[model samples]
Target: MNEPDVAVDEALPAPRPMPHGLDPDGLTVGVEEEFLLVNARTRRVASQAPSVLAAAADRLPGLRPELTRFQLEVATATCRTAEELHRQLRTARGTLTAVAREHGLRLAATGSPVLGRVTPPPLTDHPRYEALIGQYGALADALSLCGYHVHVGMPGREYAVQVSNHLRPWLPVLLAISANSPFWDERDTGHASWRYLLWSRWPSAGPPPRFASPAHYDSAVRTLLHTGAALDAGMTYWDIRLSAVHPTIEVRVCDAPATVDEALLLALLTRALVATALAATEPAPAIPQHALRAALWRSARDGLEGMGVDAVEREVLPMRELTQRLVEHARPALEATGDLAVCTELLDAVLRRNSGAARQRRAFCRRQRLTDVVDLLTAQTAGATALT
Candidate 1:
């Protein structure tokens, strides 16, 4: 297969000269998390997003509709610290869960709707989403998978693009740490993040190729748009891309986390990853396209449970060992941002409990019930229980 389009469009004004390390003001971070809304009684996905949004609008200021009616997104304002991001996510999840309950719905941060109902919920009434449904046909319906996008500030577009080139090899590592979607269509998909596998079917979705410069990245994006492969620059849904709406490198590799702490851990790791890339003298060389895709597939398939491709070494290693190396690689950045301890603790907890995929599977195994799995996810999403 040909290489996936790794184009990232410039979202900022003309670049201004700036020194590279951590930005003097510090790298800001923001998180966008999407959730599935399911009926409280039937546990079926509920197409009640509009109604839920209206009811919760006052309580949740930045709530937004997703491609499907069964999904809702909550994004936090930019923050300078992980603590702030954690607090905001907690509040957003709590408020949304409460409002959803009022409407007899449950919010699940897990990857897919738990039960096996085949008919997809209706698409949201929006021109963009409508255009997608028309263009992609059945592929559009699979867009119901939820994801977590973490935006980390970079000094400028050139810097962001440079970081992106350097960031590619590490993308699989990030994906493994955040994999939480194991079940889809009410059955274990066998892959840790079936959401990623489903989403990758998009023409523009997957790890981007290494770029020579920001101009090269922008040109590639324009080329893709001209071909109608993507509706717009925003459709360049590479695992990591320059944000079309913000001055940040958006990491879109992970499933929407099941809890606030998981979300925060992802944010911390993302910022650290970007910072480490910026400070580096050289980024990893472009892996062969085949290798890049294989690494990503392994991450989505096994998550922490299987072997992972060590893009840096170009060899596969135990996923647990690979993740530990990722933390060490980003340690300098974590320390600079005062997040080292918290990040370490959170990563440890995730490994201990296994990724969200493991926990969801365990719940089903123990009770032999999908509702029990849904219950576990809802409780975690609302922060009513710890990650374990």
Candidate 2:
């Protein structure tokens, strides 16, 4: 009889190599979609994240985190190409819907839906969430509002910050493109993108100065940390900025886009923005911060409705004219990604619809009820193209 001893410790598998790309070996597209859970029957915000995730835990393809008890987030897997990213998003959304249905919960993608009153929910017991709420208080909870943050990995932090800075001029344009939030706190705010205005209330919100370099951006972040303007880089919540953790420029300005098509339009524009900005080797334009802030307000107030933004000329113009000029400016980038058709289709869609904000407003107006808004928002779950 021979007794062979088995080792107590097993050999761990080697880490997989990151994907190769022109941007970086690790360069890829990632998305963070914050969603609000609603009662399928009542259409009110549901505190069912834990229950739903528990039931669907086996199916989620990528990281799924609950921001609040009622809010769930699903991230797209890192992919070298947009097509792959789209696939990942589709898979994730499908999984969420399947899981939510298991728990009789409906998930909705919206910056702010009109039917519910949002007060800070107890921070989920997770340490990061608890600490985040502890440090930031109700602000973290107030962000119960949903948003989709698209991150495009860059070659270096320096390049990312440069892109971030270069992006400041176009930040409002980005915001305008995805301005889908029309209601706040169960009431019509008479604005297309009330979420944008709501988000800017935080101390560290909005576009920051164009950094001289990554080092310069770091210095400013460090200074803010020391002075207590922000507890950490994450709290800055800039419309666009270099992520302290990920080597990517995080475009935080866009509202919750209605569908995958809308998300990709914004994503391509984001990547093209970085490409165009890098190619120009230009310093951040010398635009007034106040003017930028005001422009954002105008976009939110009248997403392609009121006068258009004239950043350089500093005058009001037609929204359609501004939209066309913005498209033309982004033409080269669109062509490079082969997303020109998609972008045009989506752009025309945005122009025709009243923005997500406008659509929400109209939906609420027709029904003349907040509860109806909830039903409409619930249909926005999964993907915009998906038949509810």
Q: Report the C-alpha lDDT of model 2 over 105-207, residue by residue, as the tens digit.
A: 7777788755565776644668767776667676774666677787887777766766665677677777777777877777778777888887787778876
Q: For candidate 1, lDDT tens digit of each residue in 1-388?
A: 2333442332223223448444732789898999999899888888899999999888887899888888899899999987788889989999999999999999999777787463554889989988887787888868888999989887788888877777788888888887888887878888998989998999889988677567778877877798888999989989889998888899898888888888899888888888777776744465766788899999999998789999756798999999888899898888877899999999899988888888988999997999899889999988889987
Scored by lDDT, model 2 comes in at 0.70
Q: lDDT, candidate 1, residue 151?
A: 90
lDDT of 1: 0.84
lDDT: worst 10-residue window of model 2: 1-10
lDDT (0 to 1) per candidate: 0.84, 0.70
Model 1: residues with Cα > 4 Å off, grouped in runs: 1-25, 116-118
- Off-target runs (Cα >4 Å) in candidate 2 are 1-27, 127-141, 383-388
